[model samples]
Target: MDFDDTPDEAAWRAEVRSFLEQHRGEHADARAWQATLYDAGYVGVAWPVPAGGRGGTPMQQAIVDQEMARLGLPALINLIGIGMCGPTVIVHGSDDQKQRYLKRLLRAEDLWCQLFSEPEAGSDLAGLRTRAVRDADGGWRVSGQKVWTTLAHLADYGILLTRTDPDVPKHRGLTMFVVDMMAPGVTVRPLRQMNGAAHFNEVFFDDVLIPDAERLGEVGEGWRVALTTLMSERLSLGGGGTAIGPKPETVARHVAEHIGALPADRQVLARQQLGRGYVAALGARYTGYRQLSKLSRGELPGPEASAGKLSGTRSARDLADLAVRVLGDDARVAASRDGDSTWQNAQAGLPGIAIAGGSDQVLRNIIGERVLGLPAEPRADKDVPFKESVA
Candidate 1:
């Protein structure tokens, strides 16, 4: 596919750049900036017009993302809402659900978190044990714990996955819902990481009541709806060049600046590692373009999302390691004395990227089975009921 923007795409890029230039300083607050983007129709370029989006092509969306990143603009604070939840809702939600959630979501009026992972069910997400039981009032009462939920403490709403029927196979017994984060019986506690940040949280639902109208898709179809969210998530996380953290170019610059100070014997090896990291990053970026090509053609992202994420996170982690290597002993001293923990934090935090969207082993299995059309792996529990399988 041609990398150059077509005439229309070039014009759209110009329009986006102009808007950013004019309002760059006007909205310092992240939510205000996102609301500005919503009013300007830049929030959901790939979404349908009827769904409160711009009705534009995915290329337009990419252009907007590119421009915003280039300018170092404040990121849209409701990334989980706009990037994952809104798209999932558009695909699986009822008209009333769309009308109630889309506009507020786009305008950053309500932040959203995803409640999919549990202590025992992260990589084996289909094995989650969160339960939602039918209530006497045509609603449901949920009880479970979700761990590693990003931004759950601050979110106003969440897209939750729960087991509705344990008698069925694990994947078949699932259900999805739109849940209020602050509702009674719901609690969120942050998980402190090694980097001294609590960006992730553990959330609990103690028989939280959810009205029937808040259900996302039909009961027992939550796995399908969740696939939509997961696909979008992998795409976002794998989109290279600063999606995970510092850009490859930025890392390379740091290496170049500090490598000369190293002993001549060490300089050669550092330069070689820098080149390797930069090339891997470029590969990830092109992989992102491949996913964008699918989106441009109106097709949903496929297993290639896993490939991109797997490679991108690995590249980011490698580059971070290279940066610290070039800095040598100063990496630790600067971090402790000067509070310059940029590279140190990145080094500590990027390993979780491999685990967050999906584990490296899980992603490889997806690519092997789906992309390569390899023979499937044996699954002893494939046909067993969830409850029986657990027993």
Candidate 2:
């Protein structure tokens, strides 16, 4: 894969850098900065210009993201919209759906959340029990509960996966919909975490009405659409050049500062760990580059994303542990818990990385099945009808 930026890409990078310079230290309103970026054709740079993007390449998009992260700029408010739902809509949505969602999503004027994971269907997402019964008037009544939904309380809409025809096999019965968060019978309650942040929510949908136009794909085609969403999610979550905490370079510096204070044996152990973590971080970064390379060449992501995530999250957790060990318990005070504050937030947040996108175990299954060409896991539920299955 080509690694160096083309002349056009270099020009785009310079333009993005200039825009960033103009907005430095003015990130108080993240949405405003995002709006500015979108207006300047920086947001969704890889998307088609006709589809409210600049039609840039994936490698250029990666470069833009890298520059933004390097500048410590606040992220756009439409994280799920841009990263997951927008890509799905672009691929599988009807023209009207695309027209309604894509531009607003890019500007952060409309936020969205994924309503896929239920209490019982977190990892086994296809086994979800949420039902959307069709009415004679071409709308559907949604009834179910979804847990671990990030930003549901703040979302304007959600991409919901529901069982529309339970008589069929579980996977075949599913359908996806775009539900208005303000619709009647939709409820969202915050779920407080160990970090005391209500980052996710428990949502209850009691006969929420979704018009026929809201359905994302054909009846029984939800699984395919949902796969699109999940694929985008895997790439966004794993290949986004996400750093869980301080860069390993920063950590190495911090560790070096304490090396003189530690005993000889501990110093050796610390140095060894630092070296290993640095190597692992490098591996994860290169893994992301590989994914970008594939995307640049118009190839879809594969199981290697799991490898990136497995290594990246593991490295982040290890670094967080090292930070806590070095900083001691006093750093846990909430008021002092900045990004660099003892890595308390990182320690609390690292577990979600392993669980979110897909669990470490689920990722291993993908790697085993796809990368290694191993035998597929036994699936008793494969042909089971939805109503009769024990899911």
Candidate 3:
């Protein structure tokens, strides 16, 4: 793989940086800044033009991301929708579905959440029990609960995965749908995380009606559709820079300005932590570049996706811990009119990065199975029909 960018890539990077400099938010409103990026066609660079994408290659897309992070631009909040769900819909959706969803999704007109994980099903997504039964009028009646849904409270729509034919095997009996969050029988209750934000929620669908047109794929093809979503999810979640931590350079500047104001001598530890974070951040950037190169060449870096996630989670958590330690007692407080307050927010928010989008442990398993070519996780339920196995 090419480590350094070609001259054309350098030009693209400059263009993206210029856009970010002109339009990005003023050190806050990170989500809003992302919306601006989307509006500028810098966010969905790799998406096809037909899907409201810029029709750029994955490498070009990664260049945009790298440039944005290098400029310390805050990430967009609708990343899960645009990066994961939008791509999946583009691939699995009918033409009408794409026409209806992709532009709104890319433009953040309708934020979306994934309704897949349940109390019992996390990594083993096929074991999900959300039910979507065919109604007499050929619509779907969905009923179930989904937990750990990020931004569900803010979502205008959701991509739901539910069991349609339990009599079939777990992977075969499922179906995927695009459900309006405002539709009857849908409820969202935000879940408060250890971080100071309520970013995720528990979403319940009680007899919600979804037309067949909203269904993403053929009957009994939910798992296949879900694979597309998960693939995009794994790719997007793992391959980004900046994450939840204050960029190392940002931390260092803060340290210089506030060293005397902090408790005890924090300079050494803060410097060390910042150094480690920079290394990890740089490593993730290179790894993401590698993956993007592979994707541009029509290869899916499946197993290596886990490696990026593992590194990202570790880097985010470590940076948070170190920043918190460096700040000592101040980390406990919410904020004040000071630079340290920013670090506190970063500290409180960093652990969440570890837990969200397939936890660190899950990443390890993916790496083990796909990259190492280890013995696959044994499954007695693979061949059984969904209904029979559940019974």
Candidate 4:
């Protein structure tokens, strides 16, 4: 692919840069800044115009992301809505759905959380037990629980997955819904991690009522809907790192500063590990470019995109581990010393990436089967009825 930008692309980049320079000279509240981005026609530039977007090319979207990173702007506040939920709604939502949701979503006017993972079903999302029975009035009454919810406490709405029919096979009995978070019977309790932050939460739905109009797709089609969300999710989560404290360069600087005082063999090993990490990080950057290239074409990021996720996450984990080793004593009390211990907090959260989008083993399985044409894993349960399999 030609690396050079065409004249129009260059002009678009220039426009984004100019807009940033004039509007935000320093860090700002995420909600306010994103609203400004929406007004300035910078957010969701590639989404369809009918969905309250600029109808810009995916290359334009890439330019916006690049400009935000180059300007050192804080990460967008409503990443889940813009990156995952918005795209799914654009593809599958009714006109009213699009009209009612997209504009507010882009502006962060309505924060969204995803309710897919349950205590029982996480990686195997089809095995979710959250039931949604049809009420007498033809609406749905949802009763179940979801865990590891990132922002349920702060959300105004949620894209929910439910087991609409338990008698059928697991994958074929699910349904998706757009639920109002403030409605009665919705409960969100904070989950404190070892790092002492409660960013994640557990949400319980006890007879939560979902309007008939809020169903995302036809019954027994939740998996298809969830796939759309998951496609966007892989791109979003895979693209962003754990965002923990001290970056690779910061730890490297610490290592270099203390290198002269270490024993000779120890110094050699430290330098070697550092070199390996630098190269791995460099490779991950280009792999990320490949992912962006796929996304820019408006294609759902394919299995190969997992390579980017794998490389980026592993590199992050390596850096986090290296930081702990480089700052052995400081690491011990880092979390206790400050709430903003970027490195320590990062180390604690980095392991979650292994299982976040997909575990390393899971990604490897996908790459082997989908990318390499290898033998697929045996699945005796694939076609069994949900009740039978559970029993």
List model 2 lDDT by residue over 220-246, tens digit each: 999999999988788777854556456
Global CA lDDT of candidate 1, please?
0.87
Once fitted onto the true fold, the runs of candidate 3 whose alpha carbons sit more than 4 angstroms away are: 25-39, 240-244, 252-281, 293-302, 333-340
Candidate number that wins on TM-score, 2 or 3: 2
CA-RMSD of model 2: 2.2
As a TM-score, model 1 comes out at 0.95
**Residue 83 error, candidate 1, Å:** 1.4
Tens digits of per-residue lDDT, candidate 1, 1-391, equal 3466668777998999999998888767888889889999899887898889988877788789889999888678999998899999999999999999999999999999999999999989999999999999899999999999989999999999999999999999999999999999999999998777888999999999999899999999999999999888877776733455678889878987898889998999988888888888888878787777676666776665777788888888989988988888788786795668888888888887888877898888888998899988888898899999988
Order of candidate numbers by TM-score, starting with the best:
1, 2, 4, 3
Model 3, residue 53: C-alpha shift (Å): 1.7
Using alpha carbons, what is the TM-score of model 2? 0.93
Residue-level lDDT for 179 in candidate 3 = 90
Top candidate, metric lDDT: 1
Clashing pairs in 2: none
The models' CA-based lDDT, in order, is 0.87, 0.82, 0.78, 0.80
For each candidate, give its TM-score against the true structure.
0.95, 0.93, 0.88, 0.92
What residue pairs clash in candidate 1, if any at all?
none
Flag regions of model 2 displaced more than 4 Å. Answer: 1-3, 240-244, 258-265, 296-301, 329-342
